[model samples]
Target: MSESRSGYILLGLSALLAFSYLMAGWGLPVEYPGTVALKASGILLLAVYAARRNAYLLAMALALSAIGDAMLALGPSRMTLGIASFGLAHILYAWIFLRVLRLRGMRGGMGYAMAGLLAVFGVAILIWLQPGMGELRVPATIYNGIIMVMAIIACLSKARWLAVIGALLFVASDSLIALDLFKDYDPAWRGPAVWISYVAAQFCLTLGLIRERP
Candidate 1:
Protein backbone atom coordinates (compact mmCIF):
# COMPACT_ATOMS: atom_id res chain seq x y z
CA MET A 1 0.00 0.00 0.00
CA SER A 2 1.04 3.58 -0.56
CA GLU A 3 2.00 5.95 2.26
CA SER A 4 -1.37 7.65 2.00
CA ARG A 5 -3.20 4.37 2.37
CA SER A 6 -1.00 3.30 5.25
CA GLY A 7 -1.37 6.63 6.99
CA TYR A 8 -5.13 6.43 6.78
CA ILE A 9 -5.11 2.91 8.09
CA LEU A 10 -2.97 3.89 11.01
CA LEU A 11 -5.26 6.80 11.75
CA GLY A 12 -8.29 4.54 11.56
CA LEU A 13 -6.70 2.09 13.93
CA SER A 14 -5.84 4.94 16.29
CA ALA A 15 -9.40 6.18 16.27
CA LEU A 16 -10.62 2.68 16.98
CA LEU A 17 -8.30 2.35 19.94
CA ALA A 18 -9.33 5.75 21.25
CA PHE A 19 -12.97 4.83 20.99
CA SER A 20 -12.38 1.54 22.70
CA TYR A 21 -10.48 3.15 25.51
CA LEU A 22 -13.25 5.62 26.03
CA MET A 23 -15.84 2.87 26.15
CA ALA A 24 -13.73 0.94 28.65
CA GLY A 25 -13.22 4.04 30.77
CA TRP A 26 -9.73 5.49 31.29
CA GLY A 27 -8.74 2.16 32.85
CA LEU A 28 -7.64 4.13 35.90
CA PRO A 29 -6.91 1.10 38.05
CA VAL A 30 -4.77 -0.77 35.51
CA GLU A 31 -7.40 -3.34 34.68
CA TYR A 32 -4.75 -5.22 32.76
CA PRO A 33 -1.17 -4.83 31.61
CA GLY A 34 -2.35 -4.03 28.11
CA THR A 35 -4.16 -1.04 29.48
CA VAL A 36 -1.06 1.14 29.29
CA ALA A 37 -0.39 0.18 25.69
CA LEU A 38 -4.02 0.69 24.81
CA LYS A 39 -3.93 4.18 26.27
CA ALA A 40 -0.74 5.04 24.40
CA SER A 41 -1.47 3.25 21.13
CA GLY A 42 -3.44 6.03 19.49
CA ILE A 43 -0.66 8.58 19.66
CA LEU A 44 1.98 5.96 19.05
CA LEU A 45 0.30 5.27 15.74
CA LEU A 46 0.44 8.96 14.96
CA ALA A 47 4.08 9.05 15.90
CA VAL A 48 4.79 6.23 13.49
CA TYR A 49 2.99 8.05 10.75
CA ALA A 50 4.95 11.21 11.47
CA ALA A 51 8.24 9.36 11.41
CA ARG A 52 7.40 7.77 8.08
CA ARG A 53 6.72 11.21 6.69
CA ASN A 54 10.12 12.43 7.93
CA ALA A 55 8.64 14.79 10.50
CA TYR A 56 11.14 13.78 13.13
CA LEU A 57 10.42 16.61 15.53
CA LEU A 58 6.72 16.00 15.35
CA ALA A 59 7.33 12.29 15.73
CA MET A 60 9.43 12.88 18.80
CA ALA A 61 6.76 15.03 20.36
CA LEU A 62 4.06 12.46 19.64
CA ALA A 63 6.24 9.70 21.00
CA LEU A 64 6.74 11.67 24.18
CA SER A 65 3.00 12.19 24.39
CA ALA A 66 2.45 8.45 24.12
CA ILE A 67 4.97 7.85 26.85
CA GLY A 68 3.25 10.43 29.00
CA ASP A 69 -0.07 8.68 28.44
CA ALA A 70 1.39 5.36 29.46
CA MET A 71 3.09 6.81 32.51
CA LEU A 72 -0.04 8.55 33.70
CA ALA A 73 -2.10 5.44 33.18
CA LEU A 74 0.33 3.45 35.30
CA GLY A 75 -0.66 5.29 38.51
CA PRO A 76 -0.52 8.52 40.45
CA SER A 77 3.08 7.83 41.37
CA ARG A 78 4.13 8.40 37.73
CA MET A 79 2.21 11.64 37.39
CA THR A 80 5.26 13.85 37.67
CA LEU A 81 7.12 11.91 35.05
CA GLY A 82 4.10 12.04 32.78
CA ILE A 83 3.84 15.78 33.17
CA ALA A 84 7.52 16.20 32.46
CA SER A 85 7.25 14.21 29.27
CA PHE A 86 4.35 16.36 28.13
CA GLY A 87 6.19 19.51 29.06
CA LEU A 88 9.11 18.55 26.85
CA ALA A 89 6.68 17.65 24.07
CA HIS A 90 5.13 21.09 24.26
CA ILE A 91 8.53 22.70 24.07
CA LEU A 92 9.20 20.76 20.91
CA TYR A 93 5.83 21.77 19.55
CA ALA A 94 6.56 25.45 20.24
CA TRP A 95 9.85 25.15 18.44
CA ILE A 96 8.21 23.56 15.44
CA PHE A 97 5.58 26.26 15.23
CA LEU A 98 8.01 29.11 15.65
CA ARG A 99 10.82 27.82 13.47
CA VAL A 100 9.90 25.01 11.09
CA LEU A 101 6.51 26.05 9.78
CA ARG A 102 6.26 29.37 8.04
CA LEU A 103 2.68 30.51 8.27
CA ARG A 104 2.40 34.26 7.79
CA GLY A 105 4.20 37.44 8.63
CA MET A 106 3.84 38.27 12.30
CA ARG A 107 1.87 41.41 13.01
CA GLY A 108 3.46 43.96 15.31
CA GLY A 109 0.96 45.28 17.83
CA MET A 110 -1.50 42.43 17.27
CA GLY A 111 1.23 39.90 17.90
CA TYR A 112 2.29 41.47 21.14
CA ALA A 113 -1.32 41.75 22.29
CA MET A 114 -2.04 38.12 21.51
CA ALA A 115 1.07 36.95 23.35
CA GLY A 116 0.23 39.15 26.31
CA LEU A 117 -3.26 37.70 26.49
CA LEU A 118 -1.98 34.15 26.47
CA ALA A 119 0.53 34.98 29.20
CA VAL A 120 -2.24 36.48 31.29
CA PHE A 121 -4.39 33.42 30.76
CA GLY A 122 -1.58 31.11 31.80
CA VAL A 123 -0.84 33.14 34.90
CA ALA A 124 -4.53 33.22 35.80
CA ILE A 125 -4.79 29.48 35.51
CA LEU A 126 -1.71 29.05 37.64
CA ILE A 127 -3.18 31.31 40.26
CA TRP A 128 -6.44 29.40 40.33
CA LEU A 129 -4.69 26.07 40.74
CA GLN A 130 -2.11 27.38 43.20
CA PRO A 131 -4.18 26.60 46.26
CA GLY A 132 -4.40 22.91 45.46
CA MET A 133 -1.03 22.43 43.73
CA GLY A 134 0.84 22.09 47.06
CA GLU A 135 4.10 20.31 46.24
CA LEU A 136 3.44 20.29 42.49
CA ARG A 137 2.94 24.02 42.35
CA VAL A 138 6.19 24.96 40.61
CA PRO A 139 6.04 22.17 38.06
CA ALA A 140 2.44 22.91 37.30
CA THR A 141 3.22 26.59 36.85
CA ILE A 142 6.10 25.86 34.48
CA TYR A 143 4.06 23.37 32.48
CA ASN A 144 1.15 25.75 32.26
CA GLY A 145 3.40 28.57 31.14
CA ILE A 146 5.11 26.46 28.48
CA ILE A 147 1.83 25.24 27.01
CA MET A 148 0.52 28.77 26.85
CA VAL A 149 3.66 29.89 25.09
CA MET A 150 3.23 27.08 22.63
CA ALA A 151 -0.31 28.17 21.98
CA ILE A 152 0.74 31.79 21.58
CA ILE A 153 3.38 30.88 19.03
CA ALA A 154 0.89 28.76 17.12
CA CYS A 155 -1.61 31.60 17.07
CA LEU A 156 1.00 34.04 15.83
CA SER A 157 1.76 31.70 12.98
CA LYS A 158 -1.04 33.76 11.42
CA ALA A 159 -2.56 31.76 8.59
CA ARG A 160 -1.84 28.28 9.88
CA TRP A 161 -5.28 27.62 11.22
CA LEU A 162 -4.60 23.95 11.74
CA ALA A 163 -1.69 24.55 14.10
CA VAL A 164 -3.59 27.26 15.92
CA ILE A 165 -6.61 25.07 16.41
CA GLY A 166 -4.45 22.16 17.50
CA ALA A 167 -2.61 24.28 20.03
CA LEU A 168 -5.83 25.67 21.46
CA LEU A 169 -7.35 22.21 21.73
CA PHE A 170 -4.22 21.04 23.49
CA VAL A 171 -4.50 23.91 25.91
CA ALA A 172 -8.14 23.08 26.52
CA SER A 173 -7.31 19.45 27.14
CA ASP A 174 -4.61 20.33 29.66
CA SER A 175 -6.90 22.78 31.34
CA LEU A 176 -9.45 20.03 31.87
CA ILE A 177 -6.78 17.82 33.33
CA ALA A 178 -5.77 20.59 35.70
CA LEU A 179 -9.35 21.00 36.82
CA ASP A 180 -9.76 17.29 37.33
CA LEU A 181 -6.48 16.93 39.14
CA PHE A 182 -5.92 20.16 41.05
CA LYS A 183 -9.26 21.85 41.46
CA ASP A 184 -12.37 20.47 43.15
CA TYR A 185 -14.03 19.86 39.79
CA ASP A 186 -13.57 16.30 38.69
CA PRO A 187 -16.55 15.69 36.46
CA ALA A 188 -17.29 12.27 34.98
CA TRP A 189 -16.88 13.58 31.44
CA ARG A 190 -13.48 15.09 32.05
CA GLY A 191 -11.48 11.98 31.16
CA PRO A 192 -13.05 11.33 27.78
CA ALA A 193 -13.09 15.01 26.98
CA VAL A 194 -9.39 15.36 27.63
CA TRP A 195 -8.50 12.32 25.52
CA ILE A 196 -10.65 13.33 22.60
CA SER A 197 -9.37 16.87 22.51
CA TYR A 198 -5.79 15.74 22.97
CA VAL A 199 -6.03 13.23 20.15
CA ALA A 200 -7.53 15.77 17.81
CA ALA A 201 -4.93 18.32 18.77
CA GLN A 202 -2.06 15.99 18.05
CA PHE A 203 -3.62 14.91 14.77
CA CYS A 204 -3.98 18.49 13.62
CA LEU A 205 -0.56 19.56 14.71
CA THR A 206 1.09 16.61 13.02
CA LEU A 207 -0.81 16.98 9.79
CA GLY A 208 -0.28 20.71 9.71
CA LEU A 209 3.43 20.63 10.36
CA ILE A 210 3.99 17.79 7.96
CA ARG A 211 2.28 19.72 5.20
CA GLU A 212 4.43 22.77 5.68
CA ARG A 213 7.24 23.60 3.22
CA PRO A 214 10.39 21.87 4.33
Candidate 2:
Protein backbone atom coordinates (compact mmCIF):
# COMPACT_ATOMS: atom_id res chain seq x y z
CA MET A 1 0.00 0.00 0.00
CA SER A 2 1.04 3.60 -0.50
CA GLU A 3 2.36 5.61 2.44
CA SER A 4 -0.75 7.77 2.66
CA ARG A 5 -2.94 4.71 2.91
CA SER A 6 -0.70 3.24 5.58
CA GLY A 7 -0.80 6.47 7.55
CA TYR A 8 -4.58 6.45 7.43
CA ILE A 9 -4.56 2.88 8.64
CA LEU A 10 -2.53 3.91 11.66
CA LEU A 11 -4.83 6.78 12.48
CA GLY A 12 -7.82 4.47 12.15
CA LEU A 13 -6.23 2.08 14.61
CA SER A 14 -5.82 4.82 17.19
CA ALA A 15 -9.44 5.91 16.86
CA LEU A 16 -10.45 2.29 17.18
CA LEU A 17 -8.42 1.97 20.31
CA ALA A 18 -10.15 4.99 21.78
CA PHE A 19 -13.56 3.63 20.93
CA SER A 20 -12.69 0.24 22.34
CA TYR A 21 -11.39 1.60 25.61
CA LEU A 22 -14.35 3.89 26.03
CA MET A 23 -16.58 0.90 25.48
CA ALA A 24 -14.54 -1.07 27.94
CA GLY A 25 -15.28 1.61 30.52
CA TRP A 26 -18.97 1.27 29.83
CA GLY A 27 -18.99 -2.53 29.51
CA LEU A 28 -15.69 -4.13 30.34
CA PRO A 29 -15.20 -1.76 33.29
CA VAL A 30 -11.69 -0.88 32.29
CA GLU A 31 -9.36 0.94 34.66
CA TYR A 32 -8.78 4.68 34.39
CA PRO A 33 -5.21 4.57 33.14
CA GLY A 34 -5.97 2.26 30.25
CA THR A 35 -9.12 4.06 29.25
CA VAL A 36 -7.61 7.54 29.30
CA ALA A 37 -4.54 6.37 27.39
CA LEU A 38 -6.63 4.88 24.61
CA LYS A 39 -9.07 7.79 24.64
CA ALA A 40 -6.24 10.25 24.07
CA SER A 41 -4.54 8.05 21.49
CA GLY A 42 -7.09 8.69 18.77
CA ILE A 43 -6.94 12.46 19.09
CA LEU A 44 -3.16 12.39 19.39
CA LEU A 45 -2.98 10.47 16.15
CA LEU A 46 -5.04 13.14 14.47
CA ALA A 47 -2.60 15.72 15.79
CA VAL A 48 0.14 13.74 14.11
CA TYR A 49 -1.76 13.82 10.82
CA ALA A 50 -2.14 17.58 11.12
CA ALA A 51 1.58 17.83 11.85
CA ARG A 52 2.41 15.77 8.78
CA ARG A 53 0.53 18.31 6.68
CA ASN A 54 1.95 21.19 8.72
CA ALA A 55 -1.55 22.33 9.57
CA TYR A 56 -0.38 24.04 12.74
CA LEU A 57 -3.66 25.38 14.08
CA LEU A 58 -5.49 22.16 13.40
CA ALA A 59 -2.70 20.25 15.10
CA MET A 60 -2.85 22.47 18.16
CA ALA A 61 -6.60 22.11 18.41
CA LEU A 62 -6.41 18.34 18.14
CA ALA A 63 -3.62 18.16 20.66
CA LEU A 64 -5.58 20.22 23.17
CA SER A 65 -8.58 17.97 22.59
CA ALA A 66 -6.41 14.96 23.31
CA ILE A 67 -5.39 16.52 26.59
CA GLY A 68 -9.04 17.11 27.41
CA ASP A 69 -9.85 13.50 26.65
CA ALA A 70 -7.16 12.34 29.01
CA MET A 71 -8.25 14.74 31.73
CA LEU A 72 -11.89 13.74 31.43
CA ALA A 73 -11.17 10.04 31.45
CA LEU A 74 -9.19 10.39 34.62
CA GLY A 75 -12.48 11.01 36.48
CA PRO A 76 -14.81 13.49 38.19
CA SER A 77 -12.24 15.41 40.14
CA ARG A 78 -10.57 16.55 36.93
CA MET A 79 -13.69 17.52 35.02
CA THR A 80 -13.03 21.23 35.26
CA LEU A 81 -9.56 20.86 33.82
CA GLY A 82 -10.93 18.77 30.99
CA ILE A 83 -13.54 21.36 30.19
CA ALA A 84 -10.93 24.09 30.15
CA SER A 85 -8.74 22.14 27.76
CA PHE A 86 -11.60 21.40 25.37
CA GLY A 87 -12.69 25.02 25.61
CA LEU A 88 -9.31 26.11 24.33
CA ALA A 89 -9.50 23.50 21.60
CA HIS A 90 -12.83 24.89 20.45
CA ILE A 91 -11.35 28.38 20.34
CA LEU A 92 -8.49 27.19 18.18
CA TYR A 93 -10.94 25.45 15.88
CA ALA A 94 -12.97 28.62 15.62
CA TRP A 95 -9.81 30.51 14.71
CA ILE A 96 -9.02 28.05 11.96
CA PHE A 97 -12.56 28.15 10.58
CA LEU A 98 -12.80 31.94 10.69
CA ARG A 99 -9.44 32.27 8.98
CA VAL A 100 -10.66 29.96 6.25
CA LEU A 101 -13.72 32.15 5.78
CA ARG A 102 -11.66 35.32 5.58
CA LEU A 103 -9.40 33.79 2.96
CA ARG A 104 -12.16 32.19 0.87
CA GLY A 105 -14.58 35.11 1.22
CA MET A 106 -18.10 33.80 1.63
CA ARG A 107 -20.95 35.34 -0.34
CA GLY A 108 -22.63 38.32 1.32
CA GLY A 109 -25.90 36.67 2.27
CA MET A 110 -24.21 33.51 3.48
CA GLY A 111 -22.37 35.23 6.30
CA TYR A 112 -25.58 36.75 7.66
CA ALA A 113 -27.35 33.42 7.36
CA MET A 114 -24.59 31.66 9.27
CA ALA A 115 -24.67 34.24 12.05
CA GLY A 116 -28.44 33.95 12.41
CA LEU A 117 -28.25 30.21 12.55
CA LEU A 118 -25.54 30.35 15.18
CA ALA A 119 -27.56 32.67 17.39
CA VAL A 120 -30.73 30.64 17.04
CA PHE A 121 -29.00 27.35 17.66
CA GLY A 122 -27.06 28.56 20.66
CA VAL A 123 -30.10 30.17 22.29
CA ALA A 124 -32.21 27.06 21.75
CA ILE A 125 -29.61 24.88 23.48
CA LEU A 126 -29.33 27.23 26.44
CA ILE A 127 -33.09 27.27 26.77
CA TRP A 128 -33.36 23.54 26.64
CA LEU A 129 -30.79 22.99 29.36
CA GLN A 130 -31.20 26.15 31.37
CA PRO A 131 -32.78 24.67 34.46
CA GLY A 132 -30.26 21.89 34.68
CA MET A 133 -27.34 24.23 34.12
CA GLY A 134 -27.86 26.13 37.44
CA GLU A 135 -24.34 26.76 38.66
CA LEU A 136 -22.87 25.92 35.27
CA ARG A 137 -25.23 28.22 33.41
CA VAL A 138 -22.68 30.90 32.62
CA PRO A 139 -19.79 28.71 31.58
CA ALA A 140 -21.98 26.31 29.68
CA THR A 141 -23.65 29.15 27.86
CA ILE A 142 -20.32 30.70 26.95
CA TYR A 143 -18.90 27.43 25.71
CA ASN A 144 -22.02 26.71 23.74
CA GLY A 145 -21.75 30.10 22.15
CA ILE A 146 -18.14 29.47 21.19
CA ILE A 147 -18.83 26.12 19.55
CA MET A 148 -21.90 27.49 17.80
CA VAL A 149 -19.77 30.24 16.36
CA MET A 150 -17.30 27.63 15.19
CA ALA A 151 -20.08 25.72 13.50
CA ILE A 152 -21.37 28.86 11.89
CA ILE A 153 -17.94 29.75 10.61
CA ALA A 154 -17.61 26.28 9.17
CA CYS A 155 -20.97 26.55 7.48
CA LEU A 156 -19.92 29.73 5.72
CA SER A 157 -16.46 28.54 4.73
CA LYS A 158 -15.34 26.54 1.68
CA ALA A 159 -15.26 23.21 3.52
CA ARG A 160 -18.88 23.77 4.46
CA TRP A 161 -20.12 20.20 4.35
CA LEU A 162 -17.33 18.50 6.25
CA ALA A 163 -16.66 21.22 8.78
CA VAL A 164 -20.35 21.73 9.40
CA ILE A 165 -20.91 18.04 10.04
CA GLY A 166 -17.87 17.79 12.26
CA ALA A 167 -18.85 20.83 14.26
CA LEU A 168 -22.40 19.62 14.79
CA LEU A 169 -21.22 16.20 15.81
CA PHE A 170 -18.89 17.74 18.33
CA VAL A 171 -21.84 19.68 19.69
CA ALA A 172 -23.90 16.54 19.94
CA SER A 173 -21.14 14.75 21.79
CA ASP A 174 -20.78 17.49 24.37
CA SER A 175 -24.52 17.89 24.65
CA LEU A 176 -24.85 14.25 25.56
CA ILE A 177 -22.25 14.67 28.27
CA ALA A 178 -24.05 17.71 29.56
CA LEU A 179 -27.28 15.80 29.65
CA ASP A 180 -25.71 13.02 31.64
CA LEU A 181 -24.19 15.49 34.00
CA PHE A 182 -27.18 17.71 34.80
CA LYS A 183 -30.22 15.75 33.75
CA ASP A 184 -31.45 12.23 33.85
CA TYR A 185 -30.77 9.78 31.01
CA ASP A 186 -30.73 6.09 30.51
CA PRO A 187 -27.57 5.03 32.29
CA ALA A 188 -26.76 2.55 29.60
CA TRP A 189 -26.94 5.15 26.85
CA ARG A 190 -24.42 7.53 28.39
CA GLY A 191 -21.08 6.06 27.45
CA PRO A 192 -21.88 4.82 23.97
CA ALA A 193 -23.61 8.04 23.06
CA VAL A 194 -20.77 10.30 24.16
CA TRP A 195 -17.87 8.36 22.64
CA ILE A 196 -19.61 7.61 19.33
CA SER A 197 -20.33 11.24 18.55
CA TYR A 198 -17.06 12.52 19.95
CA VAL A 199 -14.90 10.10 18.01
CA ALA A 200 -16.80 10.63 14.77
CA ALA A 201 -16.56 14.41 15.20
CA GLN A 202 -12.78 14.31 15.46
CA PHE A 203 -12.49 11.89 12.58
CA CYS A 204 -14.54 14.12 10.32
CA LEU A 205 -12.72 17.34 11.16
CA THR A 206 -9.28 15.77 11.00
CA LEU A 207 -9.93 14.11 7.65
CA GLY A 208 -11.68 17.16 6.25
CA LEU A 209 -8.94 19.54 7.30
CA ILE A 210 -6.25 17.23 6.01
CA ARG A 211 -7.93 17.17 2.61
CA GLU A 212 -8.13 20.96 2.41
CA ARG A 213 -5.34 23.54 2.28
CA PRO A 214 -4.01 24.92 5.58
Candidate 3:
Protein backbone atom coordinates (compact mmCIF):
# COMPACT_ATOMS: atom_id res chain seq x y z
CA MET A 1 0.00 0.00 0.00
CA SER A 2 1.04 3.57 -0.64
CA GLU A 3 2.27 5.68 2.28
CA SER A 4 -0.71 7.96 1.94
CA ARG A 5 -3.07 5.03 2.07
CA SER A 6 -1.33 3.69 5.11
CA GLY A 7 -1.51 7.08 6.77
CA TYR A 8 -5.23 7.26 6.20
CA ILE A 9 -5.71 3.76 7.50
CA LEU A 10 -3.81 4.53 10.67
CA LEU A 11 -5.74 7.72 11.14
CA GLY A 12 -9.04 5.95 10.67
CA LEU A 13 -8.15 3.22 13.12
CA SER A 14 -7.07 5.80 15.64
CA ALA A 15 -10.37 7.59 15.37
CA LEU A 16 -12.25 4.34 15.71
CA LEU A 17 -10.41 3.44 18.89
CA ALA A 18 -10.96 6.85 20.40
CA PHE A 19 -14.65 6.69 19.57
CA SER A 20 -14.93 3.21 21.05
CA TYR A 21 -13.40 4.44 24.27
CA LEU A 22 -15.70 7.42 24.44
CA MET A 23 -18.73 5.19 24.04
CA ALA A 24 -17.54 2.75 26.65
CA GLY A 25 -18.89 4.90 29.50
CA TRP A 26 -17.37 5.55 32.91
CA GLY A 27 -16.12 2.83 35.30
CA LEU A 28 -14.82 0.56 32.57
CA PRO A 29 -11.21 -0.64 32.13
CA VAL A 30 -11.88 -1.24 28.45
CA GLU A 31 -12.25 2.49 27.93
CA TYR A 32 -8.74 3.24 29.10
CA PRO A 33 -7.15 0.53 26.99
CA GLY A 34 -9.00 1.61 23.90
CA THR A 35 -8.10 5.25 24.45
CA VAL A 36 -4.44 4.40 24.95
CA ALA A 37 -4.32 2.28 21.84
CA LEU A 38 -5.99 4.99 19.80
CA LYS A 39 -3.68 7.72 20.99
CA ALA A 40 -0.50 5.67 20.55
CA SER A 41 -1.47 4.74 17.03
CA GLY A 42 -2.44 8.30 16.17
CA ILE A 43 0.84 9.68 17.41
CA LEU A 44 2.83 7.04 15.63
CA LEU A 45 1.16 7.85 12.33
CA LEU A 46 1.53 11.58 12.85
CA ALA A 47 5.20 11.32 13.65
CA VAL A 48 5.92 9.14 10.67
CA TYR A 49 4.06 11.40 8.26
CA ALA A 50 5.12 14.73 9.67
CA ALA A 51 7.59 16.20 7.18
CA ARG A 52 8.37 19.62 8.59
CA ARG A 53 9.52 21.19 11.82
CA ASN A 54 6.11 22.57 12.62
CA ALA A 55 4.46 19.31 11.79
CA TYR A 56 6.83 17.45 14.06
CA LEU A 57 6.14 19.91 16.84
CA LEU A 58 2.40 19.45 16.43
CA ALA A 59 2.93 15.72 16.53
CA MET A 60 4.80 16.11 19.80
CA ALA A 61 1.90 18.09 21.19
CA LEU A 62 -0.52 15.37 20.19
CA ALA A 63 1.72 12.75 21.73
CA LEU A 64 1.66 14.66 24.99
CA SER A 65 -2.09 14.90 24.71
CA ALA A 66 -2.20 11.14 24.34
CA ILE A 67 -0.29 10.82 27.57
CA GLY A 68 -2.92 12.95 29.24
CA ASP A 69 -5.67 10.76 27.85
CA ALA A 70 -3.99 7.64 29.08
CA MET A 71 -3.58 9.13 32.52
CA LEU A 72 -7.27 10.05 32.65
CA ALA A 73 -8.13 6.48 31.77
CA LEU A 74 -6.31 5.50 34.93
CA GLY A 75 -9.42 6.81 36.70
CA PRO A 76 -10.00 9.56 39.25
CA SER A 77 -7.79 7.80 41.74
CA ARG A 78 -4.89 8.92 39.55
CA MET A 79 -6.32 12.32 38.82
CA THR A 80 -3.07 14.03 39.72
CA LEU A 81 -1.16 12.10 37.07
CA GLY A 82 -3.83 12.93 34.52
CA ILE A 83 -3.77 16.61 35.32
CA ALA A 84 -0.01 16.77 35.34
CA SER A 85 0.22 14.99 32.01
CA PHE A 86 -2.19 17.46 30.44
CA GLY A 87 -0.39 20.34 32.03
CA LEU A 88 2.84 19.18 30.46
CA ALA A 89 1.02 18.77 27.18
CA HIS A 90 -0.01 22.39 27.36
CA ILE A 91 3.60 23.33 27.89
CA LEU A 92 4.45 21.41 24.73
CA TYR A 93 1.64 23.24 22.96
CA ALA A 94 3.09 26.50 24.18
CA TRP A 95 6.42 25.58 22.65
CA ILE A 96 4.74 24.77 19.36
CA PHE A 97 3.02 28.14 19.34
CA LEU A 98 6.20 29.92 20.24
CA ARG A 99 8.05 28.25 17.39
CA VAL A 100 5.33 29.27 14.98
CA LEU A 101 5.40 32.81 16.28
CA ARG A 102 9.13 32.98 15.81
CA LEU A 103 8.93 31.63 12.30
CA ARG A 104 6.28 34.19 11.36
CA GLY A 105 7.97 37.07 13.21
CA MET A 106 4.82 37.58 15.25
CA ARG A 107 4.65 38.91 18.77
CA GLY A 108 2.36 37.41 21.34
CA GLY A 109 0.73 40.63 22.54
CA MET A 110 -2.68 39.95 21.07
CA GLY A 111 -2.65 36.35 22.19
CA TYR A 112 -1.68 37.40 25.69
CA ALA A 113 -4.45 39.97 25.82
CA MET A 114 -7.05 37.51 24.64
CA ALA A 115 -5.88 34.85 27.04
CA GLY A 116 -5.95 37.34 29.94
CA LEU A 117 -9.48 38.42 29.15
CA LEU A 118 -10.77 34.90 28.81
CA ALA A 119 -8.98 33.83 31.96
CA VAL A 120 -10.63 36.58 33.94
CA PHE A 121 -14.07 35.82 32.55
CA GLY A 122 -13.76 32.09 33.04
CA VAL A 123 -12.41 32.45 36.57
CA ALA A 124 -15.24 34.79 37.49
CA ILE A 125 -17.80 32.30 36.35
CA LEU A 126 -16.03 29.49 38.17
CA ILE A 127 -15.84 31.56 41.32
CA TRP A 128 -19.53 32.30 41.19
CA LEU A 129 -20.15 28.57 41.40
CA GLN A 130 -17.34 27.88 43.82
CA PRO A 131 -19.66 26.52 46.46
CA GLY A 132 -20.43 23.64 44.13
CA MET A 133 -17.34 23.46 41.96
CA GLY A 134 -14.69 24.45 44.44
CA GLU A 135 -12.66 21.36 43.84
CA LEU A 136 -12.38 22.07 40.12
CA ARG A 137 -11.63 25.77 40.18
CA VAL A 138 -7.87 25.48 40.04
CA PRO A 139 -7.59 22.83 37.36
CA ALA A 140 -10.28 24.42 35.25
CA THR A 141 -8.52 27.76 35.47
CA ILE A 142 -5.24 26.26 34.35
CA TYR A 143 -6.81 24.39 31.47
CA ASN A 144 -8.71 27.43 30.24
CA GLY A 145 -5.63 29.57 30.37
CA ILE A 146 -3.65 27.08 28.29
CA ILE A 147 -6.43 26.83 25.73
CA MET A 148 -6.83 30.56 25.38
CA VAL A 149 -3.14 31.04 24.90
CA MET A 150 -3.04 28.29 22.31
CA ALA A 151 -5.95 29.79 20.37
CA ILE A 152 -4.41 33.23 20.39
CA ILE A 153 -1.08 31.91 19.20
CA ALA A 154 -2.72 29.89 16.50
CA CYS A 155 -4.54 32.96 15.29
CA LEU A 156 -1.34 34.93 15.01
CA SER A 157 0.66 32.22 13.30
CA LYS A 158 1.38 32.05 9.58
CA ALA A 159 -0.38 28.70 9.39
CA ARG A 160 -3.51 28.27 7.29
CA TRP A 161 -6.86 29.72 8.33
CA LEU A 162 -8.11 26.19 8.71
CA ALA A 163 -5.51 25.61 11.38
CA VAL A 164 -6.53 28.73 13.23
CA ILE A 165 -10.18 27.78 13.08
CA GLY A 166 -9.35 24.27 14.19
CA ALA A 167 -7.48 25.64 17.18
CA LEU A 168 -10.51 27.70 18.15
CA LEU A 169 -12.75 24.67 17.87
CA PHE A 170 -10.34 22.71 20.04
CA VAL A 171 -10.63 25.41 22.66
CA ALA A 172 -14.38 25.11 22.50
CA SER A 173 -14.14 21.34 22.92
CA ASP A 174 -12.01 21.57 26.07
CA SER A 175 -14.23 24.30 27.44
CA LEU A 176 -17.21 22.04 27.10
CA ILE A 177 -15.37 19.26 28.90
CA ALA A 178 -14.51 21.59 31.75
CA LEU A 179 -18.06 22.84 32.02
CA ASP A 180 -19.40 19.33 32.12
CA LEU A 181 -16.92 18.24 34.74
CA PHE A 182 -17.27 21.25 37.00
CA LYS A 183 -20.78 22.61 36.54
CA ASP A 184 -22.84 19.51 35.70
CA TYR A 185 -23.59 20.86 32.25
CA ASP A 186 -23.52 17.56 30.43
CA PRO A 187 -25.13 18.67 27.24
CA ALA A 188 -25.40 15.84 24.74
CA TRP A 189 -23.71 18.04 22.16
CA ARG A 190 -20.46 18.03 24.07
CA GLY A 191 -19.17 14.64 22.93
CA PRO A 192 -19.42 15.07 19.17
CA ALA A 193 -18.34 18.67 19.23
CA VAL A 194 -15.26 17.90 21.28
CA TRP A 195 -14.06 14.92 19.27
CA ILE A 196 -14.80 16.39 15.86
CA SER A 197 -13.11 19.63 16.69
CA TYR A 198 -10.11 17.84 18.14
CA VAL A 199 -9.64 15.68 15.07
CA ALA A 200 -10.06 18.67 12.80
CA ALA A 201 -7.51 20.62 14.77
CA GLN A 202 -4.94 17.88 14.36
CA PHE A 203 -5.64 17.47 10.65
CA CYS A 204 -5.56 21.16 9.91
CA LEU A 205 -2.35 21.71 11.78
CA THR A 206 -0.79 18.76 10.03
CA LEU A 207 -1.85 19.99 6.61
CA GLY A 208 -0.71 23.49 7.34
CA LEU A 209 2.72 22.28 8.30
CA ILE A 210 2.94 20.11 5.21
CA ARG A 211 2.04 23.04 3.01
CA GLU A 212 4.71 25.17 4.60
CA ARG A 213 7.42 22.61 4.18
CA PRO A 214 10.40 23.43 1.99
Candidate 1, 1-214: lDDT as tens digits: 9989998998899888877777667444446667788889998998998898888998999999999999999998998899999999999999888874354566457667877887888888888889999888888888898899898887776636677789889999999999978886877788889889988898888778876545
Local accuracy of candidate 3 as per-residue lDDT tens digits, 149-188? 6666666665566766666666666666667667688777
Q: Over the stretch 108-190, how does candidate 2's per-residue lDDT look in tens digits?
A: 57667866877786788678888887766777777787788787777777665666688879988887888777676648777
- The residue ranges of model 1 lying beyond 4 angstroms of the native Cα positions read 26-30, 100-104, 107-114
lDDT, candidate 3, at 26: 43
lDDT of 3: 0.62
Candidate 2: where are CA atoms >4 Å away? Answer: 107-115
Kindly report which residue pairs in candidate 3 clash with one another: none
Better of 1 and 3 by TM-score: 1
My TM-score estimates for the predictions, one after another, are: 0.91, 0.87, 0.72
Better of 1 and 2 by TM-score: 1
Error at 22, model 3, angstroms: 4.6
Which window of ten consecutive residues has the lowest lDDT sum in model 2? 106-115
State the C-alpha lDDT per candidate: 0.84, 0.80, 0.62
| Best model number under TM-score | 1
User: lDDT-based ranking, best first?
Assistant: 1, 2, 3
